[model samples]
Target: MGVVINQSIKNTIITYLGFGLGAINTLFLFTRFLSDEYFGLITYILSTANILMPLMAFGVNNTIIKFYSTFRTRQSQNTFLTLILFLPLVIIIPFGTIGYFAFDAISTWIANDNALVKEYVWLIYISAVIFAYFEVFYSWAKVQMQSVFGNFMKEVFHRLATMFLLFLLYLEVITVDELILLIVIMYVIRTCIMMVYAFSVKRPTLKFTKLAKLSDILKYTTLIIVAGSVANIILEIDKFMIGFYNILENVAYYSVAIYIASVVGVPSRAMHQITNPLTAKYLNERDKVSLKELYQKSSLNLFIISGFIYLLIVLNINELYKLIPEQFGSGILVVFLIGLAKLFDNLLGNNNSILFNSDYYRIVLIQGIFLAIISVLLNIYFIPHYGLNGAAYATFISVFLYNIIKVSFVYRKFGILPFSENTLKVSILIFISTMAFYFWDFSFYPIMNIGLKSLIIGLVYGGICYYFNLSEEITKLLNKILKRT
Candidate 1:
């Protein structure tokens, strides 16, 4: 539990730091510097790439994580890891080649009336493969319980690289065509770097042993792909559908809204990086006490922290959107809806980690498939009417219900729920803080003076939480912070 807490802290710091940098890029640079159409194009490419990643990798990343601890010797572990790494190529190489040769035909079919997006469809497809391969390497590191560095590289480095590319495009040092190509190249570079560092951390050998049952591993690997595809569709089908149904500019608006909503889940993503392996380790040891403790505490702590962040975003959303263009400002409701969905996601805490590593993982596939269908149907029904907001609405409803199902499943299987008295207190505190922030006027001063207002609000919020002892875990954390100061 301590190790989980320690790792979660580091992961949270890195995740939020990455998000802070992204907020600047998204709200200021991307929204200000790029047209909404271009912004949508960039987001569409990435969203499309994310959707394709699990298909291309064949889900070996997760299969490796699940089975890594099962290997008895270091040599066997290396051999198993090596197999997972190369096995994807057997499928991806042939598929990628087919894609390359038939790129023009595929691009023509998907190309909408938007001429600019049509011109760049090929680049998006190429970037998708690059992003997929990086996960192949990243998952190898993750199973080793080495996630902070890789998470930093994946979440932070790519954004920083993209920011630099945008600057180059702005300066005319690179043509728009070149900038599109650079996106693919940057992902490829990050993957290469991860591959290099992976060897330094745990040098995997190409040695194959008859002792390692390749057929059994392949069975699990196949399950993971189906599961991964379902999960990806649940998260991303809306974006793809939005692109297909609405104008590229609408996709751009939805992207900004999703970006803002994504911040609510940063803490959850950071925690998942560490928690997955920890859950696996606990499951392997059959340590029910530790598992339940970690599960409950993680739920409470995450809610306390993430709920506060969600409140900040929801309350200050109008002001934050004001930092961008009026077109982006129209995404405020989208942010609120999706933000609430993500907050519901966070409240489940390590429920996902617990379920994913447990025997009932097959249920995840069922639930994911169900949610994916709902997400698609809702988007199709609503997007034509509401445009970008319709997509956001679909995502919010599907994701919120999806999380409830997952939490319920975890409770049914484990006889545990990721909530407690602390959870109730945190919810009340957030409600009060959000109402205060929303009604309190900082309008007397210029918008440039907003930072001071935000700081004051944060201080007051922190003070209330401190005095109330919102969560024992959080109170201890604040004490540690004060001592260090």
Candidate 2:
């Protein structure tokens, strides 16, 4: 728990810092400096790359975490590690070849609605390949239980690079086209840095020795490719479909809303880094008690923290939008819906880790594939009819159903649920806070208004949670902080 909390705290800070830079870039700089079409094009390119990442990496990131601990012998571990290192080539080589041979067809299909996307189609492939290797290396580090630096690279490094590029664009030192190209270059550089750090932590030994359970490892990796792809598809498909069905600018507007909403998930993202490996360790040892405790504690803490973010975003969304361009203001509902969905995601806690690391991962993979299909169908049916809001609806519905399924599956399989009596109390607190703060506002500049309102909400919400002892872990931490102060 100490390790989890320590790393989670550091990871939370790093992730938020990255998100802070992203907010500045997405809301202030990109909106102000770049034209809407180009902004959306950038968003589309990155989203497409994200969608393609799992395929290119061939699920090696997840495969490493799940199997790394299972190998007992050093020789076996070396062989397993070596296998994952080169596994990605299986998909990357073929995908690159296809992209090279069928570039025109691929570009034409992707640029159906937004012709601007054609020029940047290749960047998506390049960035996805970079993103894939970055994850592969990051997972290499994670299996060693050293995730803070990897988390920083994942959350902070590239965003800072993007911030620098955006500033360059603002300074008129780089064209928007150059800014986009440089962003791809930044991803490649980020991957290189992560590779170096991963090796520093645990240098891989190339071994061609036959690994025990090689068949199971290969099977997991193959299934996880679909599982990983399903997760990314559910996340980024809305943006991709938006580009396919509408103009690129719509993708820009949606990106801002999604970014604003995604801040709620930072805690979950941060906690997952350490918890994932721990969850894998516990499952490998068949330590169901420790696993259940982790599941509940993680869920409770994440809900408590993410609940506040959801309130802050939902309550101050109108004012937050005021700071952005008016064209993006239309995404207020997008923010709310997606924010709610992310809050639900946080409530699932280490459920993802539990599922992915467990033997029943194949079942969850199938569920994910079903949900991914539903996400696509919903987007296809809704985006054309409702525009940006339609995309939000599709995402909200898919994620909501997906989380419910995960939570239920975990409970059914493990006889442990992430919820407790305090879960109900925390839910009530969040609802009350929303009602209390949603309509409360001051007449001031949007930035000041946001700051002041967020402060008040934090005070009130934190006070109630602490007073009621909704979360013992958070309460203890808060008391420790107060004493230190």
Candidate 3:
């Protein structure tokens, strides 16, 4: 338990360091340094690549994590590893071939009026290939509990490359077209780095072992592909639909808002990296005690952490948006909606990991498919009428309901719930803190004014948390820091 907690904490700190860099690059530098149209184009291209990745990878990444524990010997694991490593190419080839044939039509449809977008659509496709394969390689590291390297490479390295590209663009060393080209090249480099790290962690032998269960592996991979696509649609279709119904500038606003919302989920991501493999191994052994403990603790910890971050963001949102361009200030509603959705997601914690790795995972596929349908319908009905705000509303409602359904399903099947008196107390504390922080206005100068107010609010909030013992771990850490100071 100590090691698990420590490793999770370390991974989370590292992740946030990366996220801090990314937040600056995405929200501040990108908007300040580039035109909104160009920023929108960048986000839209990444979103498109995200939408395509699950299909291109054929869900082999997920299959790797779920099945890797079943092979007992190192040799068997290596063989199984090799199978997933190269298997996606079999499907990717056909998909890429089909994409090549219809490239112009699809490109025309997605970017109907934007010449810049049409020119860069193929770059995004090339990016999707790299992104998909790198994920497969990263999953190989994840199942072995080697997440820090992959997480660093993923959360840090990619953004660093983008930052350099932004600098190049700012200096006029790269034209808009060159910047777009560099984006594709960065993905290629990032993917290659991850592949190198994957082999360094555990070398996948090329020795062809006669495995009779190829059909079973393929079937599982196919099912997960359906499941993965459904999940991806729920997460991304809102952004795509927003771009479709509105314009690139709308996407720029929505993307910044989503970036704000995504910070709250960082804990969930860090915890999942550690817990997912554990859950898979535990479920295989039917270790209900440890599994249940992991689920509950994960939920409680994430809720506490996410609650703090959410409160901070909501309270300081007015000030934070002031740091960006005036056009982006309209994204406040989008931020609140998406932030609430992310909070709901964080509260579920390892519920996703437990379910996805369990024998009852097919239920996940069913729920995901249902959520995908709901998300698409909501986007269709709302985006035309409400624009980006409508997209946010649709996302909030769909994701909120999707998580609720998953929680209910897990409870019915496992008789485990991820809530307690402490959770309720934290919720109440969050509400009170947010309300108090909202009404108090402070005006100083520039962005430093925002930073100062945030510091004061955070200190007061920390005092309240410590006084009430909202989280023993947090309280203890704060006490230690205070004492040292």
Candidate 4:
């Protein structure tokens, strides 16, 4: 817990910094500097690339995390590492060739409804490939139990680079087309830097020697491709489907709402960087006691943290929208629905890490495939009917059901649940705080109102949580900070 708390706190700060920059870029810069259509196009390109990232990496990112700690000898570990490093080429080369040969058909199909998507379709593939290698290298570092630097690179560096690019766009130093192209180059550069950092952590000694579990590792990697793709599809498919079913600008609007809601999940994302490898280590040692403690503690801490974020977003949503453009205001419901989904995701804690690292991963994979299909079907039926709000509903329902299944399976199999008596207490606290602050708005300007309201909410929420000792970890930290002050 010491290392977990230390790194998670640092990673959380880094992640929030990144999200803050992203909010400025998403809410202000893109809205001010770029036309809505191009903004949507940029969102569409990135979301589409994310959907394709799993295939590009061949699931080697997850493969490294799950398998890296299994080998006892350096020789075998090097062999396994070497295999994963090049495994993506097996998929990448063929995928690239296919894209080259079928570029026209692919672009035409993707751009059927919105012709704007066709011209920049190739950027999606290139970005996906870049994202794939970046995750692989990041995982390489995570296996060494050193994630703060990689987390910084993952969460901060790219957003800062994007900020610079946005500034360049503002100055008319680059055309929108060049801005888009440079975004791809930015990703490529980020990946290269991460690769350098990963190697510096532990330089891979490439070896071709066949290992005993080579077949098993390959099988896990192959199955994980589907699993990883399923997760991404659940997250990004809404944006892609919205692009396909409507104009590009709607995607931009929806992206803003999604980004706002995504802030709730930041704690989970920050914590997972360190928890994932730790989960793998626990499972490798068959330490169910430690694993269960990790699971429950993670759930409680994340819920407390994310619950505050959810309250902040939901309570100030109206004021927040007032700060953004009116067209984006229609996504108020999108924020609530998606924000709730993210909140539940935080409650799952290390559920994903446990399932993915354990032998029960195959079951989770199958369930993910089922939910992915359901997600696509829901979007198909909903988005055309209800617009962006409909997409939000689809995502909320899909993620909600998926989390339930994962939680149930973990409990049934391992006899452990992510909740204790304090879980309900946190929920009640969140509800009370929301009801208390949401309607108690000041008559100031939107920015001032938001700042004042948020400050009050944070102090109130922190005070109550600390007083009740809802989370021992959080309470101790708060007390420590207070003592220092």
How does residue 309 of candidate 1 score in lDDT? Answer: 80
- Candidate 2 has its poorest 10 consecutive residues by lDDT at 111-120
| Number of backbone collisions per candidate | 0, 0, 0, 0
lDDT ranking of the models? 4, 2, 3, 1
Residue 470 of candidate 3: its Cα lDDT? Answer: 71
In angstroms, give how far residue 131 of model 2 lies from its true place.
0.5
**Candidates 3 and 4, the one with greater TM-score:** 4
Q: On residues 1-485, what C-alpha lDDT tens digit does candidate 4 reach at each position?
A: 99999999999999999999999999989988999999999999999999999999999899899888889899999998898899999999998999999999999998874667888999999999999999999999999988999988888898999999999999989999999999999999999999999999999899999886888888889999999999999999999999987578899999999999999999999999999999999998999999999999999999999999999899889999898789989899999999999999999999999999998989899999999999999999999899999999999999999999999999999999999999999999998887787788899998998889889899988888898899999988988998999
Candidate 2 clashing pairs, residues 3+ apart or interchain? none
Provide the global lDDT of candidate 1 against the true structure: 0.79
Over the stretch 400-440, how does candidate 2's per-residue lDDT look in tens digits?
Answer: 99999998999899999999999999999999888888888
- Which ranges of candidate 1 are over 4 A from the true structure? 211-213, 444-449
**CA error at residue 472 for candidate 2, angstroms:** 1.5
State each model's CA lDDT, in order: 0.79, 0.93, 0.83, 0.93
TM-score of each: 0.95, 0.99, 0.95, 0.99
Error of 1 at 156 (Å): 1.5
Between candidates 2 and 3, name the one with more favorable lDDT: 2
What is the RMSD, in Å, between candidate 4 and the native fold over all Cα? 0.9
- In candidate 4, residue 375 scores what lDDT? 100
Candidate 3: tens digits of C-alpha lDDT, residues 335-356: 8998988888988878877777
